[model samples]
Target: MKHRKLISLAIVPILVATFIATTATLSLAGSSINPRLYGSDRYETSTAIANQFSNQTVSNVVLASGNDFPDALSASVLAHELSAPILLVDRNTQTSKAALDYIQAHLRPQGTVYITGGTSVIGSNFESLLSNQGHQIKRLGGSDLYDTNELIVNELNSTSDTVYIASGQNFPDALAISSFASQTNSPILLTQTNGLPKGAQEYLTNNEPKNIYIAGGTAVVSGSVENEIKSISPNSKITRFAGQTRFDTASLAYSQLAANPKTIYIASGLNYPDALSGTILAALNGDPILLIDPSTPLVPDSIAMYLAQLYKNGATPNVTALGGSVVVPDEVINNVVNLLNGQSQSPLFNITTVDSRLNFGGLPVNLLPNKTIGSTLTLTNTTIPIAVFIRR
Candidate 1:
């Protein structure tokens, strides 16, 4: 008791807890991640935002470094990429000499469908394709207007039901972007996949977007991009498409777009568009496009559900024994078929939407909840050929 004044006190636990709490709070507030840097200063500005809010580092960025951010008119163009008007041709139909013959046959007076767009060389080549096709589509933009506010009052009036085709990088100078939010007073910079122009920036000053795809490719984000348009828009409609290396397969990408569609989003090759698995799946939207090739199990949710529902009585294929990079269980393969046809097998039993939990100890732990079968798609043809477009 004489040494009470000199007691060592056990406040260590409290201090440790305080420190951890502080650290966690700060991390939750915001932590930056380095993405593969690409494009001009405006693009760099967008990269800086990614660094501030993300938690990953990019060792290698793919797209070339160039200043592609839009000016006023260009910003108007970016705003235009809200909802895409995609016209998909079936692979079977596409391969038919008749299909190519049809497209070549339908090449309008100057008919060329621009498939992609960003803030770089996509402009000239884009114009050429459309022009060569006999169409005269001109970008109505100036410079530095990623938000489409400028285009709202001025542009939309001119484009009525006009399919503004853009591919391989676009976002015309943001006089104002107008592809979406036709009724928003000043055209609330509505980009489900990317950021809006300046006005959208002002509108989204304190809000998040419906969806924001932060890729380091041609569709790179612009300067202070998030702050510029996140608030002006809505998060429920926003979709951020980051953590991608490139757009490889037609099948994978189609799934993504179906999950979240957009007019202005990042893609792998703008010049050479890939075949979309969705195109085929669309054919069977109301029917079943079964992938019964025991060699390759059907994974697309739409297709899987169709298969599951088609075989409520268990007539689905036996693809659990296929040899590939995957090792699927038998019941799962069968269940997938049942679920696909709109039949109700425990909704929780959807192996197609669950994680392949593998634990080192006892049984694997599933860390996520179940998912709902949203939509259906069909693949009329399994095999598709790559079609290359030559801009004359």
Candidate 2:
């Protein structure tokens, strides 16, 4: 009995090793990439993102209205500065339970919660709720959305010579530069397409940032606005990042921010909530966030083209999709995987294992025959520990 047990113990490791080797070989056939989905809803997604940093103690939390984008557009930089998570709350609700719970659990004892936008946008009741919990609350709202953005920038007390200007009328331009802005500790100021907002004008006139980067094309941010910015900060070096579409604009922004990233994040371009919270997480890793049209089944052309060049240069970035399938569907993610594999369609197909009795490390494993295994196999929780072989 002792001899038999020793032989079984030896065999188990060999089987495990063999299984891992086989699967590793199959995984290497294509880019070892997969999309990790964050949450089921926007509110839940923010908590999920916050949980990513659970290992560390968060000192502050930024609360913004999920109903609008303008107030939260400039919150990323502030969140990065505070080493906090940007949590989205419903303006109608007195409090967001998920956000509150996360704050209670992670925030330091004396930590303060920052609220963007006025009481009209987030309400006095929400502030009262946090104050009741013995948490210090600081409101950074102004007379208007632009003012709120400027207030957030002022709160940063950033002396960095670089600043970013995006269209306040839309979310794409602002969201595109969010991660980069947060990473660099640069304030992202919002402006109108034809004219600069008073808040932004005052900031430019006073600070005169040496480097100004304008996101979006001339149509989104008119030449007049650019010239106005130049005139306000004449000594500042100005650069504009624009593309044919919002998706293209995101690609261009990311390409300029990171040369060869090992990880890339995707969020729906149609909405701002996912990207808003996601920017903090991406910024923490110095990664870029690419916007995708969730309505489309395939990846955006510009994103695909940009990723293709990265793959050509031997980059296999791990792609993560923020939000649920409703916002960023499985089809779009599959297309990205296929693109990385240099295939127009999925190279995966169901393959029946020839040996069902195979076991590795006392766990059941499905062993594929050498002749039938494909180039890649996507495994889920229910179907892992699979070993594939190529028929010689």
Candidate 3:
């Protein structure tokens, strides 16, 4: 009996180990590769993002104006909700050649393709062209940007306590936060800097979203407009996230809105094409997109600081540069890579006048905020984790 019990115990351990190995394999199968989806231009870039899900079967797809901003800003929520990708189509060309080819190759024989905006923005024949290709078409748009925004919001099956608001005149703020908005199912509404857009006002009047997050500072969205928002929903709380520049604002958004993003997409702040497509890809991967200028000599200060802080906290995030060399450039990529590899540039000068400080009797520095200075202070570890390197 003792011999049999010993044999059973050995067999049980082997069985448990085999089960764990099998479970791990199954879990890993669901997680896929993180690819930098891009193309020659905006049209192709959007196609590349859609191709990421090509292997899987989807019943629907969403189309938005490639040349404009307002329609696409409000389309992300519906796109995410429907498990659809937002493809950019030229208003005059109807659909770009690259997009049509991608659809024919990757997303054919699907149930429907919902196109946003009316015929004026997308051309009247665009719908018919898709219909002729055997793709069932549904168009969503209104007479103006405000009306279209309202129309888009109404399509949502439900709403959350939070909503995101950005200027309709531009695309940066909206693109930067699209992934977070989609993930949280928060509706993004467009507003003028000085006042609220009609669609935004209408949506607030109809549905109550208690928490509203405003992207960009007063320059992009003015104080008067903020007051109007307060008047609309007096009880609702408002939060603003902005920085010295658009790139800073994007980094701030990623830092505050996302929780330890495992991956981040770096795109040009000067252009819209790369980021427009990149946003959808980032959202799909459950990541955030940080903006940077490819033309700059070094990574912008705010972005570098944010990345340094992230690295200091023990995060090894996957960094992807969107667009080709022309859009993001090699120097920018090198700077970001060096940061991730912990090969940051050395400081300009450290303790230049150490003897001078000794001769003058160095004073105890109180770096701690809001602390009253005292005669004696304890000094812990003296090493600073981060140092700023300045170029002369």
Candidate 4:
């Protein structure tokens, strides 16, 4: 028989277990992986996003209606071309006042402020407010959203042979391709579901771009429109980025257009304000803006899987959410965190025991149950001399 001494190691197990639980909690709730950029309202949120561009020299500012999305959908490329920030404003004097203040403070002296819509969307009073500040104001509004889009493209003065065509009826498809458009200095023209907008038709016929990328499926932009595009620009190579849903379309666009983004900005696909302003930031960083459905708690399966694969491939890009909790809730971020942690398809809470080996004075000891000691002992490498057990 071997003589053995009973050592009381009750405290070690409790401490180690507590540390593991706390660490797991922190890892799940940590904001380091996904930071949010939002405000109390859409107007203020655009301002909050604009603040991110403060470090850079922003000589031009693109102003669009916060209440509407059409005119602003195609402004990202123009904003990127001018090295400016896209700020959304409302007709409400109070809301527009804040944007004006931001412009006055941030805009370089004699900086040009480009307004996207006509007086109907963004009233002339707001234009007057911007002009009163001594900043040169250029209003790009046309007869309709399509014309406005064409005017914006013309302002780009881009000689690039690539052009993107997305639906004018909806906001998602255009925004899906906005960042890529900004990157290539390509113009994004809007067309009706069944026909091409006159302005877009004329522009395509005149410029005759070498490449035309159409966003969304036939449901939003029917085959008729594609045929019309072919008639107008026969030589242009047309590629369509469409999916069963808007989220899928956005994912497809990101995967095809942006090769390897250093950062990914996740925005609400149901709404347009956050993404409208965020596009400039994405373009400036040469990153991709991925749209997420806010109504669902979990991220779309396709996006979650793609992100998990990106992580597994050793690409750890910084992820940022674009709106407040109401727009993009914590549950969505939690799901994103799981994907980034390489646990997208795994169980939610994975509770497992740590190693049972104990390091005591440079010696490995296994915890054995003895009649004298009623408790089991397990250990990890810690300052404590005794063994410990950690279940996380």
Candidate lDDT scores, in order, read 0.27, 0.76, 0.67, 0.75
- Per-residue CA lDDT of model 3 for 45-141, tens digit only, reads 7777777645466667787887777777778878887877777888755448876676666565845787778777778686777788788887788
Clashes of each: 86, 1, 0, 2
Candidate 2: residue 67 Cα off by (Å): 0.4
Q: Candidate 1: worst 10 consecutive residues by lDDT?
A: 15-24
Instruction: Name the weakest run of 10 consecutive residues (lDDT summed) in model 3.
Output: 18-27
Tens digits of lDDT, candidate 4, 1-392: 53323233434342222222112331432225547888888877788888876645568999988987899898899988887888898865565765777887888777898999988888888767667777788999998888898888888879989999999999998988888889778889998999998889889989999999999999999999999999999999999988999988887877777656777788898889998898888886567777887655578876776677766666666777788866775556666767767775322211111123234456654433321221345545634433233333
Q: TM-score for each prediction? A: 0.27, 0.78, 0.75, 0.78
Candidate 2's TM-score reads 0.78
Per-residue lDDT of model 1, residues 32-143, tens digit only? 2111122222233223222322224221111111223222212322222322112212223222232223234333453334322233323344444335655545343333
Candidate 4 collision pairs? 378-388, 379-388
Error of 3 at 328 (Å): 1.5
Q: For model 4, what is the alpha-carbon lDDT of residue 391?
A: 33
Arrange candidates, best TM-score first. 4, 2, 3, 1
Q: Give the poorly placed runs of model 4, Cα more than 4 Å off.
A: 1-34, 55-57, 345-392
Which window of ten consecutive residues has the lowest lDDT sum in model 2? 2-11
